[model samples]
Target chain A: MKLTRYNPSTLTDFDSWFRQPFVGFPSAAQVFSDSGSNRLAADIQEDKDNYFAQFEVPGVKKEDLKVELNNQILTISAEKKQTAGDTEQTYSLSRAISVPDGVQGDAISAKLENGILTVTLPKAEHRKPKTIEIA
Target chain B: MTTNCCNPSPTQQTAEPEAAVMKPRYFVDGTQEAYEVRVELPGVPKEGVSINLEENVLTLRAKRTPSALSDWKTLHRELKGLDFLLRLRLNTQVDEEKMTAALDHGILTLKLPVKEAAKPRRIEVQ
Candidate 1:
């Protein structure tokens, strides 16, 4: 089975329909716009048994974080609050990643340490490769 | 055949180097008594963080703990392993001896108290 890469900034349905004619040309506005706050950077890795996904979420408390998996779509969300003097501000961040087949969703686990969130997805037993001997 | 002696060989050229230093995101706010600074340093541990105050400038540096995933294959990558550095020039006078700092959940918070002499004073009319 093939796995689709995680891309947070992909255009939506409405955007794709409107920008179909200008697919080859890049927009100047997008080149200079600052989208760092709206998107979270992530690193995805895989081994023989498990897949790891890591994200940076500084200044966010564990209580304010939410992780959910529905229809093979894993979503992570958090709200970061900052207070200065008398004024307080809250920033919301969210990201979604598509999980591949043969994963044990029930046994998946997540951990947050040093402002980094790591999600581990273990592969199923049948997904492991087996070697057979010929007589 | 002519030899290109002046030009360096392709093997001598070095590969692209990774970014050595990065400025971490930070916020600063000031009130009547003190100034508060918050710096975001993801993946940095307490032992790798350092703060220095000299003259009117404050410098902060943090190093992230190295990862031990050499055997894993990377499917997608966006985060880089780089050290964090930030420098700020303080305009107001602060008491360095009374300053305090704390690190929690990868966020460093610093409180620099305003000097007594620098605080605003009111005078009554004669």
Candidate 2:
């Protein structure tokens, strides 16, 4: 009897291939929602003075984008509408990130440019790092 | 020398580089007259995007603007510093000369008009 080699990598390859629909050709909705999660991907970075959060939100108008900060939680919500032929489609996506300490909530500012929403949270005056000189 | 049956060899594993080029997410829709393709290319300026059509295949490439905040500490990251490359094969004939493209809010929209001869026409009943 001939024996077959059990390769574990093949299982992972098959799993990823099955997750993406149509294999080589992906439709618009499939790529937009990301396997039906409907959650927007984001990146957060911090410097000595400020914390920056960037969100990828394509095909969304500025008026439809909303950013809210409450109780140390930053929430980003957006709505995208598309009309093709006789059908109309609307997709809503929202994601929240907990803010760290020492953030100036009232001074937070958000800007939408080139399909990216950057929310900048400045650190409070006392929260900034102080460079003490040697006496 | 001895080896486990389930453990794969170290040389067989290939690790993809973190900065490798990636295909940006896109959506395509079409009506009878034209097809609309929208590509999400965040952090890429209008001048960094290029579209080319050769034969029946359409190619789109976008280079993202490099981040200047390299000294900042990353708290969480989902975006990568990689360019976008996408190639699509068109089964239907398209009017290449009449095609139009627009970039707004980091999203690129391409409108490919269908060839007049290839458009579906309803035959009149006698």
Candidate 3:
């Protein structure tokens, strides 16, 4: 959706109008917007005693984030809002994943920093990854 | 996962690259006073981000720190350990000197403030 009437003519029609030497390739503006809900990229990392999930949730305020854990299920939701003039806009995104067995529900911790959200889930006392030496 | 994050920014930037640099997905929103540009750059550290504006062109580059997975198993592959690279042609209307940028939670935001002369002004009553 085009939110503004301002057209970036300089950015879009530079090579075509001015740069004659660069005739083959004119347009250089590569604009990408992933408004899809599934585009929220994430990664899962695990250690001996804990599982850590790191994901990109930028431009989302802390108060707009809603995270819930229930029955080994983890759900993350966020809403981003921007107000300009008389227009108020909102972008809502939600993603969920299932936690492995033996993770401590009470110990799950989440932190949103620098537009990145990191969630850590600790393994139960006896569920830690076992390391055994070969005989 | 789609863009290769190792190549350099293109002089005449295009939609696709030569599998050398990672072109992150981003969105640009503009207001009368400022234009907000947000790019997704997961795991990129503070020191890894670099932004340069020359003439009417802006280049954005960042390197992402790898995850903490010990003995990783490739059951699924989506997000890659990559570097972000993007080049954009800025209009003369953009005030580069007044531009500001910030990175938070894997997102990079660039605030391009409009020049006073470029901004629309309200006329006083006669």
Best-performing candidate as measured by TM-score: 1
Model 3 off-target regions past 4 Å? A1-39, A82-86, A131-135, B1-20, B30-34, B67-76, B104-107, B113-126
Interface RMSD of each: 4.8, 6.2, 10.6
Better of 1 and 2 by lDDT: 1
Colliding pairs, model 1: none
Per-model TM against the reference: 0.75, 0.74, 0.64
Per-residue accuracy of model 1 over A1-135 as CA lDDT, tens digit each: 122354449854322322331233335223312364655667877788887888888888899888887777677888988886677899877766666668899989989888988899898987755678897
State the displacement of the C-alpha of residue A60, model 3, in Å, after optimal TM-score superposition: 1.7
Q: What ranking emerges by TM-score with the best candidate at the front?
A: 1, 2, 3
- Predicted model 2 interface RMSD: 6.2
**DockQ for the candidates, in order:** 0.38, 0.33, 0.12
Tally clashing residue pairs in candidate 3: 12
lDDT by residue (tens digit), candidate 3, B1-126: 111112233574555644566678776666677777777776788898999877666788897665555564322234565778877765536787888988876778788877788778899999
lDDT minimum window of 10 residues, candidate 2 chain B:
B1-10
Q: Judged by DockQ cut-offs, is candidate 2 incorrect, acceptable, medium or high?
A: acceptable
Predicted chain B of candidate 1, TM-score versus the true chain B: 0.79
- How far out, in Å, is residue A86 in model 3? 5.1
Number of the predicted model whose lDDT against the real structure is largest: 1
Residue B111 error, candidate 2, Å: 1.0
Q: DockQ score for model 3, please?
A: 0.12
Question: Across residues A39-107, which tens digit of lDDT does each residue of candidate 3 receive?
Answer: 445566666767677666766778998889865557678887654435788987765555666789999
Q: Which candidate ranks first by DockQ, i.e. highest?
A: 1
